[model samples]
Target chain A: MFRIIKKSLKIGVVTGQYQKGEPAAVPVVPEVKKKAGLFKRSFAIREVDTGSCNACEMEMNALMNPVYDAEQFGIHIAASPRHADALIVTGPVTVNMERALKDAHKQTPDPKLVIALGDCAIHCGMFKGCYAVTGPVERHIPVDVRIPGCPPRPADILEALSELRNGRP
Target chain B: MPEARLCDDVLKVAFPAIRQNAPVCAKSSHFVVPKDLLPAITHYLHTQPNFRGRLTLLWACDHRPVRDTYGLYYLFTLEGSHHWVMLSTELIGNDRLFPSITPHIHAAHWYEREIRDMFGLIPQGHPDLRRLVRHEHWPKGMHPLRKDFPWDRVLGRQQGEHHFRHIEGEGVFIVPVGPIHAGIIESGHFRFSVAGEPIMQLELRHFWKHRGVEKLFEQQTLIDALPLAERVSGDTTVGHGLAYCQAVETLLHLEVPRRATYLRTLFLELERLSNHLGDIGAMCNDTAYALAHAHCGRMKERIMQLNDRLTGSRFLRGAIRVGGVTRDIDNGRLTEIVEELNRIQLDFSEVGAIIFANASLTDRLETTGILHERTAWDHAVMGVVGRASGMDCDLRRDRPFAAYDALPVNVALYRYGDVRARLRVRGDEIHESIRLIRELRGKIPDGPIANEPSRSPDPGDWTLSAVEGWRGEILYMVMAGEGGRIHRCKVRDPSFVNWPAIQWAVLGNIIPDFPLINKSFNLSYAGNDL
Candidate 1:
């Protein structure tokens, strides 16, 4: 027990301070509104991987790590879609996952925002016209925000979330 | 090109009649055998005392307009001799049927099913001919890998449900798990049969996330397919990319410079390091040891950041190209890597010691999920799972590709075949990976990084490349078509073999230990589903 405490102390402020100061790596997210005042409270998000290579998932998971900690901003990865205020969908929607993606979106309460979180999610990226890929995430359900990259970095993800917290763009 | 001695011996033993007719080694090592002789040759080679060649790959290509029949290739790696023998046969006419090797080689079950689903080839005696990749909703008589099929065409889903095999008994109740999970993981379904606490049977339904990767590869040019290969499995970008490049290099006969080979080795080890740390942490997390998980997560993130510093992408995508790696690391960057690694090793070992000292954590991992040696061999498991089970095979040591031939790798092996053993293997491998990186630091050769191919590869040429990825052996067989196009590319992830064995691994363990056992193997759904 003493060792655990000692170890924690040595690690020393592992969590990030994204809210207090400018983040080190700020990816350019276009179309950020200055003052919409939509998101003033903490948000709970449920991540849905339609059919990713898992690169996006890794980056999203990294956001919860000590350096890029999203939890410090009161953003949490909810266990269930029912508990979430927004749905963050990744990858191009495969045929088998289309129904499930819609189901998760339906399960989340009304007024819940849907953020499509990769190039694949935005426009089916490289997987466009794949036989198994039905369409992009928006084609199946409505999307409020789209973050594009093969996989957006952890900072880019936080920036997008912070943008959403400030206003719906 | 000199013929390997084992290849000559295999020919002499399997086809004695062919020697009297004509010399089989005329068309290089790859021999085109008569369709009827395939089963006999396979059976003889498999049963022969001198030549116990393991069936490595079985795939089919649609040869329309040029030929009426679909051409099938079976590659076997003869053990102890490092000899690869390629045998091709054509399944003539519309009734494309080939004798199944599953009756003798049990591991051929999935490959045959894949061939059936992708190329519309019928395996005559396959026990389970149900859809492997394509689901029940897919239209009948539509094989997507054929050249005639368009890459973008999507037939609307037909009305049907995949009939999962169920256990019916008085007390055996079904516990169906996700196509979607409570966690932020990819989609895969697992049906468990439990009497009360103990699991009676496990039925799996993956391929939910199959985004027509193979078909997409067929659409890309030889060099353009590197990005697609990198995304084959996100965590294994380096492994898959290197394997694809190796095949392309071999096909075009382009030699990668010494400096590039060392750099490739560095990235591969880095990938292995990050993944192993993440998996070890995940395994602990499953047992509710959140502290160890957090520490490990921190370590993993550090490695990923290091990857980003070296290469542009965190996963090391776009770092590797068709001929060699795109990025080059000099001495100054190498010093930074060594210093960071030293710090990480100290931090990681301390965390590992803490986790080990905890009795509850160690007890939970000790004997929870045991996969016996006999069962592992029966399934022909690869990578860490196989090593944990005492199936002593590491492709780096056995096949020795890339700069691996220059240096010896001390493969971490254990006989326990339990969750603890798997964890131990990963821990040991982490240390070994760090050691490997340090050894590669000062010894890197000064030369050109890449060698551009002098000429485009001839049509109808093909080659196979295998890399011992962090998970296991990742194999890519690239076949060229007319006008420098890829005819067919078959990707066989280690998960393709390991996923089936999970059903057996969960036979006696309770439902609670499933996640722990699953994490120990840590099989990639994307790799298998693709």
Candidate 2:
């Protein structure tokens, strides 16, 4: 127990301050509105992987790590869509997961936003003509934001979320 | 090539039938056998005393336009031998029925089911013929891999039912998990039958991320297919990309430069180090040890950042091209890698000591989720899971590729097949990978990084490339078509073989401990589904 405490103390505060009005690290599709703050301060997100290669999920998980420390901005990954204020969907929306993605979107209560998290989610990217894929995430449900990268880095993901939280482009 | 002669001698002595008639097509290590002799030959090789052959790959290809037949190939790696023997047979003339080898070889269960789903080929007298890849929503009698099925065509959904094995008892009940999970991970479903708190049976329903990857490979040029291979499983970008490139190189008869070979080895080890660190942290997180998780996560991030600095991608994508590598590391970057690895090794040892000292964490890992050696061998588990269960197989040491033939590799083995055993195997491998990278930095040669192919491969040319990815052996079998197009590309990720082992590992463990066991194996959903 002492060793644990000592290690924690030695690590100190590694979290970085959330910078606002900075240049976007990753390009976001259709630009964020300057004054429509759907999630004011605290943001609860439920990540849904419709069909990804899982690189996007890896970057998303990095947000919770000590360096990015997304929880410091009152952003947490909710266990269920019902408890979530936004749904972060990844992948190209394979046929097998189309129903589940819709169900999760429906399950999330009113005034919720859907953010597509990767190039695959935005336009099906490399998996464009795949027969098993239904299309990009927007083909099934409405998407409010799109984070574009093969997989956007964690810093890019945190920046987009902060932009959404602060209602700043 | 000498190993092929050895395989020929061994097979002729054991089975006189092959000696009586010449093989239909005898290449370096590939043989064409009569369709009826496939099951017998595979069974003999798998169980023979002096030649304990492990079934490495089983895949079927649609050869409709070229030949009115479906081709089935069985790949096996003999114990203590550097060569792999491939036996293929043809199901000709509207006869889609082939003999089932799964009755004798348990590892062929999933492969045969996948063949049936993709080609509509019936495995004669197989026990279970249930759907493996195609879910209930897929329409009946529609096989996507056949030449007649268009690549971009979408079929309407149909009503279908998947039958789960039902268990009935007084206190027994079923718990159905998700195609959509809570955490930021890939999609897969798990069904656990629990009696009180302990699990009696666990059934996994995967393939929720299948994107017709193999079908998409057809009609694509060899260069264009490399990106698809890199995306087969995002985390294993380097492994799958190297295997695909190696297969293409072998088909084109191109020799990679010595510097590129060493660089490939260096990148593969870095990929391995990053994944092992992440998995170690995830295993600890599952056990509620946040301190270890944080430290390991930080170490993993550093390695990933280093990968981005050296090669332009965090996952090492586009680093490997056909016949060679795309980027070269300078001396200064090599020194940086050595220094960074030294710092990581020191930090890792300290974290390892802390993890060992924590009794509560160690208690949860010890003796929990034990997979018997017999079960492991029967299922033909690969990689860390197989090593943890005492299956002495590491493709890097046994069948060397890249720069592994010159550099020595120490395979980590643990007799006990528990969560702790898996953890220890990953830890040892992390150290080994760091050592390999440091050695590579010292001895890396100066030369061109890539070799360009002069001409296109012949229409019927085909070859196999196997790389021991961080997870396990990733196998790619590539066949060339007219105008240098890829006729068929069969990808077998290590997760395809290791996923089944998880069900056996979770038996008798409590339902809550399932996450710990699953994390230790860390199988890929997209890789397996594809």
Candidate 3:
């Protein structure tokens, strides 16, 4: 038990300092702005993976790690859709998950931003024209932001969410 | 010599009506049994001790344009050898009445059900021929795999409720969980029959994520199919991608360079390391031990970041191609990777000690979700689940493809078949994978990363390649089509065989421990659903 406390204190303050607007430390940000508005408030997101390879989901999980520490940025993946301010949907949206995707969108309270998290969510990605796929997530629900990549990195996801918090949408 | 004798004996003794015998690969053979003798052949192979016929794959293809009949293929492997015996038969002109082998081979139950749903081929006397992949609402008789059903045809979502079997008793209440889960995981429904806490029965319904992976493979050239194979299961990108590439390389008779083989092995071990670490953490978290879980997640991210640094993708996507790997790990980078992995191992050991040291954590893990040794063998479970249950099978060791043939792997085994045993297996494998990466780093020879195929794969040529993915045995069967394209590609992820084992494991366990036990097995929903 002594080792736990020692290790905890040894690696002190692992959370990122996002308040200083140090975007360069994180890799590859497509947008930069020295603005402060809705960034002051906490944001809750509910993740809905309609149909993905799960790679994007892995990155999303990484946001909870000590290095990323999404909680420091006032972003938490809430358990219920009613608590969420945004919905992060992944995959090309399979036929089986179309109804659930729509319901998740409908359940999220008003002023909810829908972000398409992967390439598949953006435009069906690699699963185009397959019988099981029901096309892109946008076809089922309106998406405010589209993060494109087979899977966007955790840092990129954080940057996008932070940008959302900044009231850029 | 004994392997060949076993294959020949099975054919000559049981399948005297065999019309043609062809070599599928160096270690595998294809036998075209007469349609009338298929049931006998399938039954005999499963019953015979010499054959030890473990049904690995079963699927059918519509040969209407050419042969005017549907061709059904069943591949099986013996207990010890790497040799595979493929039995195939033709059903004349949609007369899809083939005798079901499930009455004898319990493992072939899902495969037959899938065949009935996808190809509209009736497995005669299949006890429960319920729709497997099509779910509850897919229009009856509309088989998606047949040539008549266009790949892009959208059968707009049909509305219906899935019929789940419920126990009718006074105290037996049914608890239904998820086609959409609360956690950040894939969709799968579980119905548990609980009689005051202890689960009397559990039935799982998955395949909600089946996005026509096989159909997508049919649409791409072999060169472009690697990315789709990687996405078959997000976590097992290297395993599935390497298996697909190896199958293609075998069909084209192309020999990958030594350096490429070593690099592929490196990437595969890295993938394995990341997943095993993450699983260990998940299993701990399910038990409410958040400290170890968080640390392990951070370590996994370290490896994932390293992956991005090396191959531009966190999940090792696009790292492998048809002939070989896409990137090379130079001497400088290789040394650096070994050093970083060693440091990670040291940190992992520190965190692992805390996980195992806590008696409270170990108490919940021991004797929880126990899958018996006999049940594991009967179901033919693969990877860590099989290993934990004392089913001694690792494709990397048995069938030695890529660098595994040159570099021996120490297979982790246990007998308890409990949550702890599975956790112990994963823990041991993480160290084993790290050792393999370090050893391969030292011995990696300098050479070309890939070899250009001399010609396109010949039509009608078919081959099977098996890789021991982080989960279990991943098998790929690729057959060449007209104009040097892929005709049919069947992927059997390790989850395909292990998912059934979960049903057996979950019995008698309380409702609350279900998540912990399920995380212990940690079957891939995407891989299994696909």
Best by DockQ: 2
Instruction: List per-prediction Cα lDDT, in the order shown.
Output: 0.83, 0.86, 0.83
lDDT of 2 by residue, B1-530 (tens): 57668777888776665523332222336667888887889998889876677888999888868888899988887776645677888888889899999999999999999999999999997899889899998999878889899999887899989998878989899999998887777899999999899899999998889899999899598877999999999999999999999888877878999999999999999999999999999999999998888888888888888887788688888899998999888889899899999999988987898998989999999999998898998888889999999988898997788999888899999989999999999999999999998888888989999999887888867778889999999999898888889889999999999898888899999988998999999999999998
Segments of candidate 3 deviating more than 4 angstroms? A9-13, A16-40, A167-169, B157-159
Ranking under DockQ, best-scoring first?
2, 1, 3
Model 3: what is its DockQ? Answer: 0.56
The Cα error of candidate 2 at residue B29, in Å, is: 3.1
Q: What tens-digit string does per-residue lDDT give for candidate 1 at B1-530?
A: 24465566558665854332222222225667777777788777666766666677778888776778898877776656656677788777776788887888777888899889888888998888888788778888778888778888876778777787888889889999988887778889999999999999998889888888999988878888898998888989999999999998888888899889989989999999999999998999999998998999999988987887789788888888877778788889998999999999999988988999999999999987888887786677879999999977888888888888887899999998999999999999999989988988868888888888887888777777899999998999898877777878989889888998888888889999999999999999999988
Candidate 3, residues A1-169, lDDT tens digits: the string is 8988876776566566222232323332233222123335677878888889888888888788777888777778887788888788989988778877888788888767778888899899888878899889888887777777778877777766666555322
Better of 2 and 3 by TM-score: 2
Q: In model 2, where do residues sit more than 4 Å from their true spots?
A: A17-22, A25-38, A167-169, B1-7, B19-28
Could you tell which candidate, 1 or 3, scores higher by DockQ? Answer: 1
Clashes by residue pair, model 3? none
Better of 1 and 2 by DockQ: 2
For model 3 chain B, where is the 10-residue window of minimal lDDT? B13-22
